[model samples]
Target: MKQFIVELINDRFMIAAVLLFGLGFMNLLLQKNLIKKIIGFNVMDSSIFLFLASQGYINGRIAPIITNGVFDAEVYINPIPSGLVLTGIVVSVSVTAFFLALTVRLYGIYKTVDFDEIMLLINKEAE
Candidate 1:
């Protein structure tokens, strides 16, 4: 019964992740605002990260990070996904910062956040 419950939970989590990924991709493709696009990108990243972390978990397993010198491979969860999330967090931060900076510059030049409005403004200004 316990194992069945665990499998059911895992299946639900995977399904949710797949749905999130689909929505995130759709948002990324559909949104015109840079902020919305960045949010979608972050959501997509989170879905994958969650999936990785879930895979690292095991029943009755201790965390992978050892306190002393004891290396219990059989009971410990995988640390790779944690490390991966850390690196991804840093990368995502940098990307968001760069995107925001670009957005600010775009606004400065055109004084509009709307993509269509900015393009039209720039064209008119150019004429």
Candidate 2:
């Protein structure tokens, strides 16, 4: 248990990412407001990006930039995680924008951003 605790402490970034993800998940689950849910989604996305970035880094390795005519693979960190994080960021931004636009339209129609309220309003209108 002590060794596990020490290892967990050493991997600070991973621990932070997990905690952030938990917070975001809780926010997403508990929030009634659409905007807050969106914020939580963004937080979750950020945590994932952080995890990927941390995974891409090594303690002693340099970035994947080849220099000095050294072509050894061991000298540089893996570039895939960085690329994945970048792509995820772009996709998340687009998704977030789309969700915000939808929220705006929903608010315009329902007069409230609370998802439960919107559902109630819809049921009332249907009845």
Q: Candidate 1 residues 35-122, lDDT tens each?
A: 7877898888788777777776777878876887887688688788788878878887898889889989998887777776877887
In model 2, residue pairs whose N, Cα or C atoms come closer than 3 Å (at least 3 residues apart or on different chains), thus clashing, are none
lDDT per model vs. reference? 0.81, 0.95
Query: Which has the greatest TM-score?
Result: 2
Which lDDT tens digits does candidate 2 get at residues 6-120?
9988899989999999999999999999999999999999999999999989879999987788899889998999999989999999999999999999988989999999999
In candidate 2, stretches whose alpha carbon ends up further than 4 angstroms from where it belongs are none
Q: What lDDT score goes with residue 15 in model 1?
A: 71
How far is each candidate from the true structure, as Cα RMSD in Å? Answer: 3.3, 1.3
Clashing pairs in 1: none
- Indicate the worst ten consecutive residues by lDDT in candidate 2: 65-74
